[model samples]
Target: MTMTTDTRPRTAVQLQTNGMGDLVWHAEYFRCIAEQSQGGQVTVIAAPTTMARDLIGHEPWLREVIDFDRRPRNGRRGRHSGLDGLMRMGAELAPKRLDRMVMFSDHPGRAVIVCWRAGIRTKLGYGATWLQRLLLTKAPRIAMYDGPPVTGTYLDATAFAIAQGFCSAPLVPHINVRPDALARMRERLAAWSQPGFALSIGSSEPFKQWGAENFAELAARLARTGAGVLLVGGPSETALAQAITAGIASELRPQVLSLTDAPVADTVAAMSLMRACIGNDTGATNIAAAVGTPAWVLMGARPPLMHDPSRMKMLEGASLADISPAAVEAQVLAGLA
Candidate 1:
């Protein structure tokens, strides 16, 4: 392992490189270390895919969210891959003079190497492989464990932190939307009399998406209860949003609002106002659940996205198409009640 003679601060730094949902899923663990244990903020070195800056930039527990170009993927070499990128990343991190680095990733070797090169005195991570064990400064003795990458891995990390006397408390998932964004969402929803429910209509893949027809049926049923149905997604899902709105009964069409074009922050704010969210397995659903809104995730290709029954409920089927809108609606109604 590499070493540096420069004196480093005691502040702990976390290196994470996952998507938005994964970031949100592990929020509590981050808080446990930064707030509960350190009684101060921790800096986060996050990947672009995590959107850490946009999602949790305002989190009080974080001192900063630094952008980290992740390793290569899809047969193309990334800017931060191999020896050259590793050296560059190390140089960049050296300025922080970090003493401790915690890595939460499936590929722990690269992160461990980078921290070593940066001269971080202590590097903590799960030694899932031989390379990780050889490189990591400290790691929990994890028994044979196979579970969801985001939730299960974090749970193990939390347990390790507790056993090591790093943090005493176990935190729960909590998301904070910008006050301005929340106000905007509140102002927009005020125009309607009915309470709101959100339908997250976006998915990373076609097979993961619950079709427009299914959402339309669910929206119409929820609308009959006099609740406003907000169709939430990104710009790419605008057509899908429109299709779902069109599928609704003509009389209740006014109850459905399209929010596909809304900014991510605004959509997150809107989620807080919802009675509940029925979404496909997507980042939006995770965001909704993190914000304390009950989210029913329609699991198709992916089963058991996370392990927070208090906020997230998984509805799995052989395929996304197999899950009926009626069954989803029933779950949502029950959750709301």
Candidate 2:
């Protein structure tokens, strides 16, 4: 509330310290907001994690990253001794000098407190929990069509509208891809005469895993048509990815590659290389779409309305839980050919 809305060349911080999916959605909003900032320095001050690094470092817009991992442990709810973590981070920051500060969290439980402490003023956010609304100068109800509503009331639906400006258009969530990164991936894919595809059959959440046997069937059908396959996921997914590779050992397996890392950059790069990507609703699915690979994202349990469109092939559906692998294979083969 201290920083004025001036056109000064100043620093801005986007605080998105929540779930990876929410962070990804917030990143897209940050992208649009950063573009309008002209040449100001932009940074992401998130809890230290691999996902934060991949997003901030790989994002074409952000210039800096600050880790305030201990903020959660600073006070009430936080398990740490006191505000040592808070003070440690405070010593690093200088106050009230920012041009603007946008608090981009689905729900800013206490994330707003950190922004205020760091000398941020111009707060922007969507849904709030209790004290959250008091922190933002502007809070818009973002609106968008997420297929048919799960409930009759918009408030009751999974698709909540976070409105912005005077525009009535719904937010089309997306992740940005670097041209240089894309150039490298494109060159790599060029080695093969046919366009390649990515398949992800893993998730941190056990319920989200779509199983390897199902993927193998889809991989085989794509191979028959000449599209190469690359499987990417977490290290724990080795057993699953291996099973998939073995299932298509006759031909498709040789074309497939497996990669896993906590930050999982190798898998992300693999996702980018594919002309088309198919997978269960999971981190890699988001990574593929964020990196610009046109995807046929498959989902199980979760609904499709939860996904963003920059990486999705234009289609009509709410979630991929009902998605058949053959349906995805047809889309992949056609895109590759």
Candidate 3:
């Protein structure tokens, strides 16, 4: 991670978000600017994933979060209005007079068009998307992967960006376990937490859910092993939590911590206290990894490369969605035991 200083230090913004993990990975490309850049500013703008901001906005180093839902990137199909959004971004960025811009996109189809509109001279990003590659001053090709703990690819990508000379900062994962996230998690768990707990199994996407009955069975087994089972999710998951709770044997009910009513911020924080979390492939898994909480994430047929592999509590599991309750429970035990 070495670079010749392009003095006249400029404002750096990473524009793109494929997911929470993607946002985390690319945002880190400018971590030094957040910590060491005396005058550089870091802005993360994306089309907004459901809870992506929870990870970035929480960080003090990041200055602004721009999310536009109605206007999806449309420059690719030849519709020019999407460039209008980029123009807006350009106007917003114009005042600062950007010295160096690195768009952490994997060949952003329409975003590169916007970057051009914004007038960034030294654009650095993955050279993907056919029409857009010409826009990059330094756009490298990307390799594909399938594994757990998504942060790895992101880390690799950033290192590539630096090695290629787009950026002049050292690469570090740079994800600090959010202090407020930890406190909120602990406060929610204070009374209900037991010796051990298997985490809530839910995702914002319907396809990501492992059956609630299976989740309940895992909880029952963890309870038998002297661990309390916690069900963590947003309101959408209450029924699943209830079903998991009802299905578990009455004796283990006391050990079951249900906090679907708890605010999402708290749910994310609460994950840190769990002995180990188990869940389907989703944002919660990334959140769990960010907090250093041991977790067994069921990729559920999705490629493993989609999540961070290093932070995983357990990487051994079936790739299928209907991973047996026993299979997940075993991984949780392996992580905890």
Q: How far is each candidate from the true structure, as Cα RMSD in Å?
A: 4.2, 5.8, 5.4
Per-residue lDDT of candidate 3, residues 250-332 (tens digit) = 98888888878865556666766766777776667666666677667776655454334556643434455457878777666
- Top candidate on TM-score is 1
- Candidate 1: tens digits of C-alpha lDDT, residues 203-280: 877777889999999999989989899999999899999899899889998889999888778888999888888888
lDDT agreement with native, every candidate: 0.76, 0.57, 0.62
Ranking by lDDT: 1, 3, 2
Q: How many backbone clashes does candidate 1 have?
A: 0
State the TM-score for model 2: 0.72
The better-scoring model by TM-score among 1 and 3 is 1
- Give all TM-scores, in the order shown: 0.87, 0.72, 0.77
lDDT of 1: 0.76
Off by over 4 Å in 2: 1-6, 9-21, 36-38, 56-60, 70-84, 127-130, 138-168, 179-193, 261-269, 306-324, 331-337
